[model samples]
Target chain A: MSVLRKSTVALVAQRAGVSVASVSRVLNNLPASESIAAKVRKAAEELGYVPDAMARSLKVGRTEQIALAVADVGNPVYVTMMHAVSEVVREAGFRLVLSSTGNDPNDVVELLDNLERGYADGVILSPLRITDEIIARLTSTRLPVVVIGSLPQGVLLDNVRADSRTGVDIAVARLKATGRKHIAFVNGPVDTVPGSARLTGYLAAMESRGLPTTADMQVEASDFTYAAGLEAAQVLTAQATPDAILCANDLLAVAVMKVITSKGLRVPEDVAIVGMDNTDLADHANPSITSVDLGSAERAREAARLLLARIEDPSRPSETTVVSPWLAERESTAEGASRGKNVKARKPELEEGVS
Target chain B: MSVLRKSTVALVAQRAGVSVASVSRVLNNLPASESIAAKVRKAAEELGYVPDAMARSLKVGRTEQIALAVADVGNPVYVTMMHAVSEVVREAGFRLVLSSTGNDPNDVVELLDNLERGYADGVILSPLRITDEIIARLTSTRLPVVVIGSLPQGVLLDNVRADSRTGVDIAVARLKATGRKHIAFVNGPVDTVPGSARLTGYLAAMESRGLPTTADMQVEASDFTYAAGLEAAQVLTAQATPDAILCANDLLAVAVMKVITSKGLRVPEDVAIVGMDNTDLADHANPSITSVDLGSAERAREAARLLLARIEDPSRPSETTVVSPWLAERESTAEGASRGKNVKARKPELEEGVS
Candidate 1:
């Protein structure tokens, strides 16, 4: 009501050449005449009058609430992204509802299929695992969906992705500037979307720095989660402590920080750490953390914007947008007084072919 | 204290100058800083601290379970409530099921209606927006329902409400004891049950302290949400800076703290803050918020107990219970030497009549 300018029944009534009462009756399905209902429907469709905006405008958009399905709620990255998406969705006459979709690929398909029931007008999905079944569902699902992560070859949907090269470059540049040469890279499974891009980016970035990266210098966590990071970091630490370590993400960085500290080492003092996806986890971790800003929030915001655009006009070509990355330096790289205020998220650039 | 042999862990903890929990975590192969883990391991080796026990007691035999439908998962309050309810329910030979009912009143109705399909033996519902339709649903539903919130007068359904008096007293007492007088109150919509009770309690508490109150001293948020709190706090801060501010919940308090800090004012140093509901959000917030512990954990525990009791015997007279409250004094109240480890959660003592 405050931020969003919603299409009103009065406008629909005027367009349909019917009374406002008739529009209400038709909209609410309260036994309106067939002819009146048709006219009201046409008018509403033209104006994009959100159906039954009562109950919830009644906050954001009640009848037409947009749902954002994420992989995990525990991750601070999702929290930050949710906030950004919510702001954008609310600004455009839609309320954002959240559902933490399970990690199973079938779960993603089931969620998309549930959209057919019209529970939400559209969805902004961030799935951890992508399957062929999910792609097929997306192809058939009439519901406008804007994905905030990678989709495989030839699949057309509005997508927003983080430029992994920028993240790797940012992390490497920060570590190098801080005079740390013995840097190691921890990544997720190389077969996955982010894993492949990040690992490749790490390799290229290291090559640019003329740093020799033997196979031993690269540790692969089972996943991008803290639990996976913990198990992987134990393996990494058992080998030898590097002067600097680049984690796949903030959660992994936090795990590595924990593993390092529990081994009677100081963060930054002994082992400088640079994490990707500068999430609130980085901001709140003790001694904080310097992270490569993969701009999940901005990606989410753009995804939401893209979703709304397609909802308004569904024929728009599915364009892939790449959100740039930056460095959010903090205590984990070098213990410093400056805190909280330096966290950054970069804007998106329309990129070709998911690169 | 009863089953665990603390001497070994304590000895290691004292020798390592770290927490017993840290020592336990490191030894148990849970997530802990490597430095701390290494120190604890060294200490354990030096003291020859071998864990004294191996066998763990396991509870079994649950024929049925209760479902707890919470309003919002985004708020950490529901997580705390769920954990408490689960423990209580499990102890009673019943598993706890969880359903996140959206803010929509229809969602609440739909959730309650779904219970008719023989989902669970009972339900513990913590609804955000209570409607007359909801009241009717609660009255007519065949499923035993325990509400961890205020019910309308005379509609008794095993209601467990937070003792607003204790919460207000604890907040006011802590603020006053710390020499804050010019305290402002920020509340949610007064039409809501908790909002009404908290506002009345706040006003009455201020009067009891012989402190003058004015219309400007009270600000009403549209909802008990972070966004609403942010808007309400912007209004409050624009009016004037108070010596201290009391919020309806932890979310509002966090919002107010942000507003204060952004205005170049330091918490507790420039203005103290006290919030109701000692959720993990308060714990993780910067300059960690001191709050009136409304004992949501206790309320949920009672709610689970009530639901189970009603399920066991339908002839039992429905009762209302009031949970006691306390102050979780943190950095927001006073910049104290003791930090991080002093986080407390008070157990419930159910009193009568909601006062």
Candidate 2:
């Protein structure tokens, strides 16, 4: 017969010269005698006893396991968010399970089905796009789910979305302040949520700034890849070159920087650039790409918290939270024509006046 | 009583006007009448019925789920390898359960202990570092495990490792062939397995080429981060400037590229850069960094296969597989230093000498 080692609780009880019941009570933070608690603590320290959370969770019917299903795990922005989520989850005494669905709706459905098998107490989904069927399924699930993007109307669910409108507004405002009237918008896959949202945000921001939204100023990338960004830049620059360009993400911005430098165009002089997501790549990129922070970490934390809340109270009303985005001005947009003596400078005004 | 939806198989059988056994046999690809199979297939298609592999695995006393536990999920190289592993796992009709241990040995122990609950048929562990205690626990587990890196000597465990020596050798040879005699090595923490192996590989490669391996030529980074890489480059460049620099990973190489470019040093003309891992960052860098392909995808595929083999037959002898690295020459290398140029230049000398 295979022999199993004694558990830490048993060892603590033996070392403390106390009953196993008393040790258990003290360990579980239940009402116990002060003398017994002191003895158990000393014994645990001597024996180097560490409580097994998994076993405790099993008895409580709560695994303390949360699942995060993402469309593309290879993206650095998503990877950073996942890292932040893991840190928060670990600090909260929970385990995280990650699932990569590769930007496919069917794969997302399959991942949701797998999550429904009770492996995780709650789930955080970052689907590439939202559909009616997906929204309905999410609404009906018994487990807690926090989506990492915007959802359609009439389907109540916990959501944490990035305010790309504010992000694009800042980018456009900065560009206009830099005396850049002709600005271009480079986007990735309009069918995707971020792509569509960012595009709409750019258009609205440009219109609010009294800048003409022209067809020639908008360029859509084949995909959210560096190569696609490079190819899209070639097309965008072939026509009238804009004095400033706003990218949907940092990858495209980095690619544009490469192409612009190779073509002997000086950044912030010939053309300024701004990107979204503010990923580590942006900070490490040449010129240290100026980007907008979408509060990805905060969004991840909020989603995890919402999921945990719903897991604790399933009958609670679903909530949607929107995390704001901020501008991170770097070398890419440091000094432009407006900063020089060639353009007029505008005085500081109210935030509403700019937006 | 709560109402539950009918099983897909039952729905398919009802739609086909056939017995449920016939539908089950057809779904399982078992021997069945041609008419019955045709009816079942049509009915399943009409009802959009998809088989639940999880339920079947449970009935057969197997979960058909494999866990992949890594130290850091945010690392792009790991993410790339995970994509490949997921592809292989999904193709084999098995689900993947991913967990991040965050480079903590305690977390590693906890994750492994949790895996013993029989949720997954096997596990793939990519530990940041190997310790005796970890090795002991891994050896004691009945579940099949495939480690991504080296294991302790004489330990019977399957593993897949990258050939860092060959990678460094090829990088050094390419730089030397391009008339770059002075080379520098920028590495991450020497305590890490990859970091130490890469440092040793650089030293061995330099010695093989009869080049001086001076202390000033090697700069150890504080950690595997872009900031550390930037600081390491500053230290390396402060002493004597090397004609070529080899980095431990693509992220580090990108940092070096950014730093060197900012300092007015032209890549390939003033300094050539070569990085390990051949990640997407390398291809997207300003000069399209030259890197050594560590065969991460192949390694992941091999690890999955080894895990499946061990799961099928527990008594089989453990094996270790090493994947050879290859040089991916891009624009980052010196001009006219392509593989074609190297082969052509070497062929004439060999022919003349032999003749």
Candidate 3:
């Protein structure tokens, strides 16, 4: 095994029989004579010495590594986002460090600590729950950070967000047009930013359509998991049999669809379902679940772009970019989709409605 | 934003009115005078100087990060393994760096480069194909690495492998017990390690069962994907209709199932199906596909544990651990499952066979 240690310009100088400044000139390709540069290069090659990325980063106060912290990796939507983020970072010549809040309860705390310790040049985080502590830490950290979800108004951090309100509106409108009076909604814990926004959007869409949303028409899952979706489905079905169900996320929707089918019910015939986040699972599921494309990949790419911009120039004004959500109509909601022509969502309308 | 810069031992010594060596002694928890230690700690607090993890790591040549490189993230089985690996690493107080070979074609080359640069403390790699170059680099890398697939014989390195041969035997025996005449095998690209192993296992299992293996009974998929599965199924069904089909992976099986059902074929009645990997996709598919549980999670956990052990003591003799595979019977293969009531596989026999 080769023992790797920091290579110094002094070693290159000694090997080349020149001063350290001459070696530096050769390394930087600055004004060194051809013979001296050739000797320095040969000596450096023989000694296997190159300016280390870590040492150069330490001197420039940049690590060239970016971290991405997410709530869970098991979630297909986050996995999609992570894939895009990794691609963007790699293209930008930076390494990516990953953290899952599922395993580490103190995600935000560790994130702040890593920032303070110069672990990475920037971070892109998708917090499950937006809290004051998060905002405060993000505000105080010297490193650049870009958030991938909703934040409090007027927060200074650069953010890439999704317009899920419009997503819920499109889903509810599609379901209502199918001649369904009782439409059920399944959400994750309301304390989360996504859950609460989806709930509000569902209620608003129902009210706009002159449909009443009773207590039995809505259920809050303990968490955003397939198991929780199954439990929530049982609770909603036992209380009132809604003609359609709108799930807050694709994982929950897949699970609920499984439960619905396992119980001898046919989708889009007995019950129509709509899920958010058009992940691959949505397309691969039997019946091919209809979902709202919350722009997971787009959001991640934008977040990486914003973070890179911020890292390049911290003095730039903080900007918030919201990717518009659209419905990906599939077999799950195909029954009600054609009731109204041109119901397919358009990015222009959503972008205008949200921002 | 508060400026983040590395604090020097000299700063701590100056604040405490002591020598730099004294400050180092206190920080290292060496036996120092009580008053001196107390003064140094207070001075460190006042100067906002905690021994930074990055600086300390540079001095000791250790970084608390482990890298995991996989072929694809779209595959649920790899996602399961990645989840398990992440959980283990987090519990051990180490961070995980993920690289997908699908996105980064130079994964092994970059791995070797990073090892020479000290990018990570250890690595857990699951190479889709093993080559002599990989073995040579692995032998020369200074960082500890654990491979999660089969290696060439007598190559000394920590390895965690899966025994898919027994898995295929169980699938075929179960299928034949139902009195099926023609059984088909749909495999992924034979160039891949798993694909090649599953194909070999299928042929051997068929010969052992006294069944005549025909050229028309086997089809090879271009890749282990749902689309590939659909395409392979079309080819398999168009030429000769088999009573049952065993797929190389769950994704392929799920896709084949979709095609069969869509074309007015009744699963387990017209044709039975089986999948390997036993991922969540299997359980959530319309018929809940029967699958071979390759012990992905167990292998990941064992790999992480082995890497940790090797990192703790590199002098220990290298060990090879094999995880046994088992069949998970579901609705897809329920036709002849009850003919013999002892179909639930026992782990003891398979474990002993592999070891």
DockQ of each model against the real complex? 0.04, 0.50, 0.38
Model 1, A122-232: lDDT tens per residue?
Answer: 888898777788788887898888888878868899999888876897788777665556679989877767788899999998899987777777999998877798899
TM-score for the B chain of model 1: 0.74
- Candidate 1 regions with alpha-carbon error over 4 angstroms: A1-63, A188-192, A214-217, A221-223, A226-231, A335-355, B1-75, B79-147, B150-355
Question: CA lDDT of A171 in candidate 2?
Answer: 88
User: Which tens-of-lDDT digit does each residue in B214-270 have in candidate 1?
Assistant: 888799998887778888989988885577899999888878787777777767666
How do the residues B162-257 of candidate 2 rate in per-residue lDDT, one tens digit apiece? 988789999998887776667899998887778888998999999999877688989998877778889988998887677789999888898888
Candidate 2: list runs displaced more than 4 Å.
A1-60, A336-355, B1-61, B336-355
CA deviation > 4 Å runs, candidate 3: A1-63, A103-105, A115-118, A336-355, B1-61, B103-105, B336-355
Question: Whose lDDT is higher: candidate 1's or candidate 2's?
Answer: 2
What is candidate 3's lDDT per residue for A1-355, written digit by digit as tens? 1123224566777899876556654554445689988988888788876645423533343455788888877788888888899888877667676666663336776656754555577889998888887788889888889999999998988998899899999988877665556688999989898999999999999999897889988999999888899899999878877767999998899888988877777786667899999988888888899899999999999999888777655778999999998999999876533322212322233212211
**Is candidate 2 or 3 superior in TM-score?**
2
Interface RMSD of each: 6.4, 1.7, 2.0
Which stretch of 10 consecutive residues in model 2 chain A shows the poorest summed lDDT? A342-351
Among these predictions, the greatest DockQ belongs to 2
lDDT of 2 at B112: 80
Q: Higher-DockQ candidate among 1 and 3?
A: 3
**How are the candidates ranked when ordered by lDDT, highest leading?**
3, 2, 1
